[model samples]
Target chain A: MEGLSIKQRFQETLKSVYFPFVAIVVSLLFGSVVILATSSTSPLTAYGHMLKGAFGSIAAFDSTLIKAIPLIFTALSFSLARRSGIINLGAEGQFMMGALAATAVGVATPNLPAIIHLPATLLAGFLGGALFGLITGVLKVKFGASELIITIMLNYIAKELISYFVNGPLMDSASSSYPQSAPMEPSARLYKFIPGLNVHTGLLIALAFIFLYYFFLWKTTAGFDMRVVGFNPSAGAYAGMSIGRSTILALFLAGGLAGLGGCIEIIAVQGRLMMTSFAVPYGFTGIAVALLGNLNPLGVLFSGILFGGLSAGALRMEVMTRDVSSSVAVVIQALIILFIAGRQMFAFKRRYRYRPSSEKRKGKTVVDDATEDESPTVQATAGEGE
Target chain B: MNEVVSFFSTTIRLAAPTLLAALGIVFSERAGIVNIGTEGMMLVGALAGVIGSYVTGSAWLGMLIAVFVTVLFSAIFAYFTVVVKADQTVIGTGMNLLASGLTITVNRALFGASTSPPEIDSFGIVAIPGLSSIPIIGPIFFNHHIIVYLTFILVPIAQFVMFRTNIGLKVRSVGENPKACDTVGIRVGLTRFLSILYSGVLAGMAGSFISMGMVSFFTEGMIAGGGFIALAAVVFGNYTPRGVMLSSLVFGASNSLMYRLQALATNIPSQFLLMIPYVITIISLCIVSRKSNKPLGSGKPYIKE
Candidate 1:
């Protein structure tokens, strides 16, 4: 690795993460232009606020890290599934279900040791998400159904199901009126690594999984099978790999990761489940994180942190300068994604524009473009990218 | 029975949006490009329609503007996906978020509130002279608004388009196999772009119906996940115009039924009723997905060398 030239290393990084890197830069530039046109707040000040809010003080850093913890878990889950060719957009719903499952255990279970209680709660979360993911995965393999439709339908179903649970089965009788569950036992809470920071041991747990995922992908036979299946299932089948099993496992693992994120949120971040809240957005954002990270386990950490910073800063932006809507962050993120999608379009146009007419003599194959044929304004009807 | 008829009548009115949106998805998807961003497209169109109507005080002018603006936006999508060849899933998802955020941001900036759009006069109901006197179908079918009639008119037009013309054949050929179509001189990208633009126009109409017809208002997230449901209807309809209309009607009536059921007290939780459409979507998809039936090379990028 050390013998490799700098240019080679740079090229490799570009090959792996170039799409997201370009997307981020393009989005930022677009964001700066928008800010310039509208708000009195300069890009530098907005960025400064973001940096300060994310890492200015120990408390801020802790808060940022804590927020990123669940994202890390879910993003990693998405990466795992992506590697196996399953687009699991249901992580948000899975995350919520996981939280609901974990909370139920914590609230219902009797006395137990802190160690056992914490792990059990987390296990419940993982199992719930894994089960949810596997149901879709299994149905896909067994029934040849498009996972896309199933996952989307399941997402809504799960959302409503959980709403019902919280509203009826899980509602806290003692609390006033709103639909929400009781806080878990103190024993169920994750232990803190950083004293007084409220930074739970979940960070280390997330990091640990990252390392495990890295090793699993690069060093294990099962990982190879999953990757192979992802690249070409027919080839994997011809090579004696069980494509069905790999798909199921990949999705299950992804769901487990997302489930763990939900568990972390309950035990380490938010204490209990709340009905009609924002949980799925993070799941959707995890796709961005995975893209930003180029699907590398280690890269996800940085990307998650970056997105976490944006979220943290958005809150600050909202509080300090109510004049500038915090939704600017979403716009920025959307721009990054837009640019990435449009990157090849621009490149193709450049080629057509710059290349001499005589140079286009060969019968070159055109890449078939597939994208949503709607404007961003029409996007509200679609919701979170079904 | 009167209550059912009244509800059914109201439902056809409500279903106007879904039917239009489903038709839009059909055009885009039948051209072999999967359009998952119909939700975003509708929102943009709705906002465009509202803003246009508000500024000009003309519903006709508003519809025209909606089609034009939404088509332009769809053209951007077409430019990126058709010409540039980006990952459709990622691009489509990003487009959805971008559109949603941008519109809401613009709305808040313009309106000073993140609530409903300013109201406008709805399209007046049209009574088909003697048909209004028919027994069971009378009030539900004959006595309806222009938009409702328009939806019905589009179905046969859509069917004719999908099955009759050279363009439709080209579209079908491209969707099934771009390579095969390209070999025979069909320009897949251009067809897809046109189809998508067509989708944009109808989707705008669907959005406008919500703002200008159903409620005469726009709220944040007003498309309300109908875009995806429409996409689901595409597969359920098996890419045929007639099949799609039937699927749309089922979904529309289901949505209407849920609202009606909501009016009456039932033992089951209201959340369960809300979940019915989504649950049915999953069940139906599971069934559809069961046969491994889909357009060949569906949603896959077509690259020519």
Candidate 2:
């Protein structure tokens, strides 16, 4: 730090920000080609419409924030689990379970006051999601089963369970037999901060959570331990930390956070527990948010909003363009992932040299170079392994 | 007796797609790449198969296009995981998203929004000469499409190749210990890349079977987690071709039973019945032989010096 000049430090910061920016631009440029090939709409006009729709009016901006709120929560979930070196692909299921529990409580009590009902419903959501996440954690910890497959299976089960619940057990009796639960009691409803706007206090809750995530992960002992376990289980075990406990704990917290996101969506946005209420692929989109944010809590907030804007605008793009569905947003999200994963292309010359040495360390160096952008602890673990 | 015959036939039919995809996973995972993108590749293949059949009016042409498109997707996966040394799981997830978005967008462009594509020609049951006449066994085994027959034939062939061939040994060795394989002059990246491609082809076939053999048209999410179920089958099968086949059969049987019970309007909620295959797969996964001979470097990318 002392040796580097101010110019070098500035350059480093610029590099960190510039790569992702370039990747996004490149992806959009490629996306335009897709738009041209698939549809007759000019990419420039379509993008103009997208920008206009995302921020055209206060209402549009409010909707964008509304969409971002859940993304922030889910992104935090993915970010937290990744910190512990676990992948929680079942955020979709966890989010659904959270919604289910919150709905169960939200719809069951129509007479309670807002002060009590809201907190209870939110708690139910967190607990539901946590419990659901814990199943995968427990399975991985106890039976050594791969959480990847287990979580994927759980997603299928959760979707079916919710479909059944809305269609049968929790079906509204008087609403023309739609596959949805009865509307929530007014007490359980979330209120908008701005009267006419779609934005709700859920944004504040999401922001608070972002702060909490940062605090828990960066400033707490448990977070330190979890990060240690994530970077290297062998080192953590050697240092007397329980890897299983950390895995369970990390996943549980992740699920709980995501579950809270689900609750907010139900109480604030949807107001009803329809089968399709949480069907915006928030959980999967969260993965994109977390990765784009470099798994940093603060980064997640910004990335979440960015993704929200993309999604919010995508609908308008679909309406204005020919054959350009909102699904193009998904393609963009995936493109971002591909770009991030393959960002090695941007760093190739700087990081690698055409050294003719046939040393074993050469291969190890390449491996180290690939994982370099990850957390410092992963770098440490790589050194130890070698 | 007739009901029993139908149930068994349904089981065979249901198992075929999963069985084929699981076989693909066996090759890829054994070669040190856990191809969770099987789902994405299958999605691509399913849509491509529909497009091919729609344009060419031949199911076989659809199958060919499915394989070709899936291979293209797999190549992207190979470049990232094999050449760039990125995280396999994340890239695979990205591939799934890419496949999902691309398929839907293309579907909207080619076919109108919210409307299903026109039904195309699909493979009907090919009753083999003498074997198909042998009562219940014949009905279950012999009365299937050409793809179904191909899927069955693939089992022993895959088993023989994986166990008896030199390429199989190289693939397995690379997964178990790539460093050692590299030291021995074996091309680890090339092996892993080819294995992924092989899985792509198999998963493509599975996708085609779903569209052309199981149904005559493509709809949104027609693959419906069949790819993941195939992954479960691979794990449950202990990564053996025969084991994958048997586990796929079990899943298929449960899936068939669920459909049957739903048709019968059983006292049990149809939703819970619908969950039988997934729940059973999770349970079976837990109980499966823990002595899974998985490659040590199964999910790790090889980095060449």
Tell me the TM-score of each prediction against the true structure.
Answer: 0.90, 0.94
Please give the range of 10 consecutive residues that has the lowest summed lDDT in model 1 chain A. A362-371
TM-score of candidate 1 versus the correct structure, residues matched by position: 0.90
Error of 1 at B151 (Å): 1.2
| Residue B27 miss distance in model 2 (angstroms) | 0.8
Global Cα RMSD, each model: 6.0, 3.6
lDDT of 1 at A61: 79
Task: Give Cα distance to truth, residue B76, candidate 1, Å.
Answer: 3.0
Q: Chain B TM-score of model 2, please?
A: 0.97
Model 2 chain B scores worst on lDDT over the 10 consecutive residues at B296-305
Model 1, residue B232: C-alpha shift (Å): 0.8
Per-residue CA lDDT of model 1 for B43-122, tens digit only, reads 88888787788788887678778778788877767766666555666667777777777776667766756455576655
Model 2 lDDT, residue A139, Cα = 89
**Candidate 1 chain B least-lDDT 10 residues:** B289-298
| CAPRI quality of model 1 | acceptable
B-chain TM-score, candidate 1? 0.94
lDDT for each candidate structure? 0.74, 0.83
User: Which candidate ranks first by DockQ, i.e. highest?
Assistant: 2
